[model samples]
Target: MHDPATLELLRAGKLEILGRIVEASNATLLCSVELDGVTGHCVYKPVQGERPLWDFPDGTLAGREVASYLVSAASGWGVVPPTVLRDGPFGSGMVQLWIDTPAASISDDEDSGAGSGSAAGSGSAAHREHVEQVSDLVELCPPGAVPQGWMPILRAQDYSGEMVVLAHADHPGLRRMAVLDVVLNNADRKGGHVLAGLDGGVYGVDHGICLHSEPKLRTVLWGWAGEPIGDEAVEMLSKLASLLEGELADQLDEHLTIAEVQALRTRVRRLLATRVMPEPSGMRPAIPWPAF
Candidate 1:
C-alpha cells in the first residue's frame, strides 16, 4: 500500500513546521519531515486542533484520515496519499505525504520568470496551460456550455443568479476516486480535494470526515451515476471485499468503530452486487457546499 521507506520516514522523522494551512477547517500544518538523510514535505493535522463535528466523534478525525488512506491503498487504486497517525509537535496528528500539482509548482516559480520579458511570456503560457489542465478535471461553466466529454453534476444559480453547471472530466482516475468516495462514505469530496498531481496521479485528500456508519456520499463526481461500474473497478471491489474479511478489517478496527468497519464491508458488497454507480438519494443534499 505504502512504500515502506516513506512510511517509516513519516512515522519517525522530525517534523519542522513550515507553515499553517489556514484555509483548512482544522489546524493543518505544512511541515518538512526529515529522517536518515531523507526529507519530504507533508501535511500534518494534529488531533488536538480538530474542530468538533456533531456527526463524527471528537478527537478522531486524524484517525479517520488514516483510515481513509488505508481503504484507498487496499483498494489498489491508491487514490489517497501515504498517511500515518503519529505524534507531532502539537500532539498526535495525521501526517500525509504532500503531492505537488502543476499549478503549485508554477506559482512557486512565478518570481523567477518575472525578470525577463521572454521568460515572462513563456511563464504566462505555461500558467495558462496548467490552469487548463486543472480545469479539465473540474470546472464551473455556463449551463449550455459543458465541455465535450465532461459530466455535469449540478446546475445552480451563482451569486449573480446566472445559471452555471459544475462538471468534471470523464477520466478513469476520477472515476476510481468516485468509486472510492462511495466506499469511504465521504461527506466532502469538494473540487479542491481532487488533485491532479504533477506526477500524473489523481489524488484525493482531506478525508477527515469519512467512513461514517451512515450513508453520507456527498461529492461533485456524479457524472457516472446510474451507469454500470466498469470492469476494472468491479475487479478491484472484489479484491477489497476480500481484504475486509481479514487483516484489513483488523487494521481498520484500530481507527474505526466496529460498526463503521462493518458498514464499510456492507458498502463494498453492495457495490459489487449492483455493479452500478449509485444515484444520489433524495433524503439529503447530494453535493457538499462551497464545492471548490
Candidate 2:
C-alpha cells in the first residue's frame, strides 16, 4: 500500500513545510505532502540545504538518498523506506515517506522492553535468568560466556554499580539490512537511523553518504561480522548482482559516477563470491560516531 502512494507523492506532491528536524546535522525538514487530494507526512532534504563534505561533492546527498533506495529495492530486502528525488519549495531534494514509530511490547516484562535498540550502547543482560527465557532472541556477547547470536553494543554501570551490556537482536531482517549496507557501501549507519514502524517493520534511513567509490562502510549492524551469510541473504545478493547490470545500473548512473556504479556492482559480486559477512577492514572505525 505504501509503495505506490510513496512514489506518487514524492514525484508530484504539493509540499508544505511543517517544521525543521533540529536534531539533524544536515538541513532536514518535516512536511505535509499532498498529491491528487491525498495527504501524507514526509522528510525533505533539499540539495541547497546540504552541508559540505570533504570527501563527497557538495549538493549530492539528496541523489545519494534516492540511489540508496534503488539499491535497497534491488536487494529485495526493503530495508530502506520509500524515497524519491524531486523538486520541492526549497529546490531539488529527496522526499521520503515518514514512518511512525509507535512502541510495541517485545516481552511481557516491562523492564525488558527497549526503544529502537538505540537507547543503550551495549545489549546488557538484566539477569542471567532472563537470558534463558528469551534465549531464542539472544545469544552470548562473548564466546563461551552468553551464546552465539549476542553481540554487545554498549556497556554501562547499573544502579548497583554492576556493569551491564546492551545488545541488539541478531534477527533475520536486521541481518538482511546489514548485508544491504555492505552492498551499498553505506558510510553512516548509526543506531538512531534504524527506525521501527508501527506495523512491525524495520527501516534504515539517512543514506546520503552511501555508494562512494571508496570502501567507507560504517555501521552498528556488525553483530554478524565474520559469520557465514545465510542462504536467503545470499540468494538476495545474487538477485541484486544480476539486476545491477540492467535497469539498476542505468538508474544509478543518473546519481553516481560511472566508477561508483561499477564499484557497486563489484561489491555485490564480491560478497556473493565470498559467501560470508565481512569483517571491518580496519581502514576506518567499524562503528559510526554518536553510535545512536
Candidate 3:
C-alpha cells in the first residue's frame, strides 16, 4: 500500500541496490530504499538502462514514468503506484514501490499468438490451468460478439489450435484506467501491466512510454470503445482538467516539454467535452506487441 508518507520517502530515499532484474530488457534493479526510518522495496530503472527509442528523447523514460503517476493521481484513481525520480546507484532513475501479488490470477500465455506448441511444451502449464479454472466465469464468445458485460481485447489460439477471444470483465477501476491512459497517451499498456493488487485493487505499471506529445495511445483496453464515459469518470476528468492548469502542470513541466503538457491538457478537455470513452484512432496499431 502506498500512503503519502511512504511516497514522500520514495521521493527522497537512500537507495541500496539489492539485485538486478536480469530478465528485464533494460537496466532494471530491485532495491531497498530507506528514508526517515522508513524502508521499502522498489523497482529502479536508471536512465542509462533505457533502450533508445527513435521517437523518444534519450534518458527521458524515467521522467515519463513519474508523469504517469501524476496523471493517475490527478484522475483521483490510484491506478498507477507511487513512483518518484531520484538518483540511485546506477544513476538518476525512476523508483516505484513494489506491489506484491499472489501468483497472477490472470492468464499470461506468451506464445506470440499461437502456432507454437502444446501447453506442456509451451512451458506454462500453471497458466493453462488457471485459464481453465476461469473458463466457466468467462464466456468465450465468437469474433464480433460484444456481450453486455464483456469486451473483446484480442484473439489467440488455444492448445488445440482453436480460436480463443480474450476479453476483460467490465469493471469500474478498469474504466478509470482507460480514461487515464487516454489522457497520458500511453504507448504501451500491455495485459501483463495490469496487476491484481494485494489490496484487492487493480493497478497498472510500466508507464515509461507514456505522455508523449505525439498520439501513441496504444493499449489492450479498447473493449469500451465508443462506450459512454461514466459520470464518475467524467467528474474526475473535470477535476483533472483544472489541476492540469496548476499543480499537475507544474509537476509535469519538470519532465515533459511545454508542448507535451499542453497536449495533455488538450486531451483532458476533449475527453470531458465528449463524455465518452475513446475509440481506436486508427493512426497506428491499436494493440501493443506482446499484449499480455
Candidate 4:
C-alpha cells in the first residue's frame, strides 16, 4: 500500500510535464510531481486530450481510472497504483504513481553485480531471474508446448504461418487480478497492463475503459475459467458487496452513473452466488486485440 503522504501529494501537488508517452492512444504525459520537498514521477492523462469513443462518453475516462483505483484499494489487493483525478498542466486529468519494475531498475543500475560470491550478488541474481520469468506473462509458444504450470488461452498461426499457443502463467497475483477485472468490468485488460512491480507485487494499469454498466469484459486472463473461486476471493467479494451498500457506493457515484454503480453491486452479488470463475460469454470477443 502507498503511504498516505504520497497519495496526498498526488492529489495536491505541482506537476511538471517531462514528456509524452508516444505509444499511448490518448495524450498520456510523463510528469514529475513535487510538494513540500517530496517528489515522484507519474503519468498524467488530461481529459481534454481523450479521443472520443462510440461506446464510452467523452471526458469520463479519467473518472473511471480513479474509480478503478478505489475498487482495487477496497479489495485490499493493491493491484492498481495510487491514482488521483486532479488538474494538471494540460487540465483536469488522472494522475497515477509510476511503478518501477525490476527490468527498469536493473537497466538503470548497470554496475549491479549478479555473479559475485556475496549476499548482494545472490539477491541480484534472484531479481534477474524474477525479471526473466515475468517478462513473458502472456506469450506465444510452439503448439502444445505450454510451460509446466501455464494455461493456454488460444492456438493460432503466427506471422510466418507457424502454429503457436497463447498462454499465461498460473500465478496467484494474476488470479487475484482476474477476479478484480471481473469486478471492474474491465473492457481492456491487455497483457501489457500487468506489471511485475520491483517491490514483489503485481500491478495493473490503464483502466480508462472500465466500470461500464454493460457486460463488456475483455481480457487475457481466462486461465481459471470454471474453476471454483478461492476462499480469500470469496471473502473479499462479500466485503465488497457490503461496502457497495454503504460508503463505497457513494464514493463511486462521484465517477460513475447510478445505474453503473448498481450494476457493479449486482455483478459482485452474482459472483458471490456463482462461486466459480467466469468463462467467455461468447456474445463478444473474449480477449482484447493485440493481446499485449
Give TM per candidate.
0.90, 0.81, 0.82, 0.90
Write down the lDDT of every candidate, Cα atoms only: 0.86, 0.75, 0.76, 0.84
* Location of the lowest summed lDDT over 10 successive residues in candidate 4: 112-121
lDDT of 3: 0.76
Q: Candidate 3: TM-score?
A: 0.82
Backbone clashes under 3 angstroms, per model: 0, 13, 0, 0
Report the candidate with higher TM-score, 1 versus 3: 1
Candidate that beats the other on TM-score, 3 or 4, i.e. the better one? 4
lDDT of 1 at 92: 93
Give the higher-lDDT candidate: 1 or 4: 1
lDDT tens digits, residue span 47-125, model 3: 9999999998998999999999988977779899889998888789999976544542212232211111221223366
TM-score of 2: 0.81
Tens digit of per-residue lDDT, candidate 2, span 182-245: 9989899887787655435668889999999999999888888888888997889888888888
Better of 1 and 2 by TM-score: 1
Error of 3 at 28 (Å): 1.6
Question: Sort by TM-score, best first: what order?
Answer: 4, 1, 3, 2
Q: Which regions in candidate 3 have their CA more than 4 angstroms from the true location?
A: 104-149, 157-162
Candidate 4's TM-score reads: 0.90
